[model samples]
Target: MEELIYFHDHALVILTLITIIVFYGLISIITNTFTNRFLLESHHIETIWTVIPAIILIFLALPSLRLLYIMDELNDPHLTIKAIGHQWYWSYEYTDYQDLEFDSYMVPTQDLNPGQPRLLEVDNRLVAPTHSPVRVLTTSADVLHSWAIPALGLKMDAVPGRLNQLSFLTPRSGVFYGQCSEICGANHSFMPIVLESVPLNVFEDWASSLME
Candidate 1:
């Protein structure tokens, strides 16, 4: 996701610079004079230049629209999880598994394990099935917060009195981490999101046991 964002930004920067330089070069060549004398163009000439930019925008809008549509597409999901943001912690509910729910609190520094990442580790990591589409519903109990997972390209705001939905399909079985993006309160930085994607059978077993 980081690489994708970087490449997208790089493309925009390069294209913007090239477009500006090309437009300036064309104006300079057509005017044939560096002085301000050539700047006083006729109404028709000014209209032509304006229309040229409009034409360029039409071409640029196609790709921009496609990217927007692709980013908003949500596939058929196999499981659903609702994440509710509290004052300083997160509560997750498996909506399809008898509504089994748990609170995921930030692990203290002294409790950190060798493999655990400081500040991003939680006591109860969210569990999902690998290679399956998981739809996430988000809401806030108090102030606003944001749920984000970089590896799966998932981010949504947990607004009070409203529900927002986002979905992702994990291609591999592993743990992915993220943090609350919005600053809700003093412990906002401590609200980390941890996802554990396991095999389908394993996930089913865990979910069944959780309901019991």
Candidate 2:
């Protein structure tokens, strides 16, 4: 199901372009016909034409709603992490690991390695285990910020006083990047997010080290 959603993301881009082209062609045809004919005005033709975008919407809404519900439905999570957004940095707490916490700040572009992506790498990344259900609790310390990761299909607003919950299970190990989607301050663009998913054994080892 995850793979299907990932594929749909790309498919949606193509579908969107096709939809735009078809709509454009239809409008052009209508305009050309009305312009060439002096007796019929475009407004007269418009009265007979009713766009039932609802039909297209119905098809698009089903899969999207299904995915939304699935993402929100909480199962027995193997781990839980709390993320708090501050002025220009992020703090993470592992609730299941004795509430161990740490701060994750963005690495400056000048200090990045040759293969590292500018403005996307961070000093400390939120780490988790692959193929494990992890629940995330998000909140803000001061202003509103959004935690978004496109690959995981996760995005939730971090409100100052409210806690928002989200969950995901990464099928593979890799580093996923995101940023402060909402404009919160002067350095909003500099507040990047990086998540590293490792093997279960590696995660357990890392968690143990954090405890020490």
Q: lDDT tens string, model 1, 111-207?
A: 9989889999999999999888888999999999999987767789999999998877788899999999999999889999999999999998988
| CA lDDT scores, all candidates in order | 0.86, 0.87
Measured against the true structure, the TM-scores of the candidates, in listed sequence, are 0.79, 0.77
lDDT (Cα, tens digit) per residue for candidate 2, span 182-212: 9999999988889999999999999899899
Displacement of residue 84 (Cα, Å) in model 1 is 0.4
Worst 10 residues of 1 by lDDT: 1-10
TM-score of 1: 0.79
Candidate closest to the true structure, highest TM-score: 1
Model 1 alpha-carbon miss at residue 122, Å:
0.7
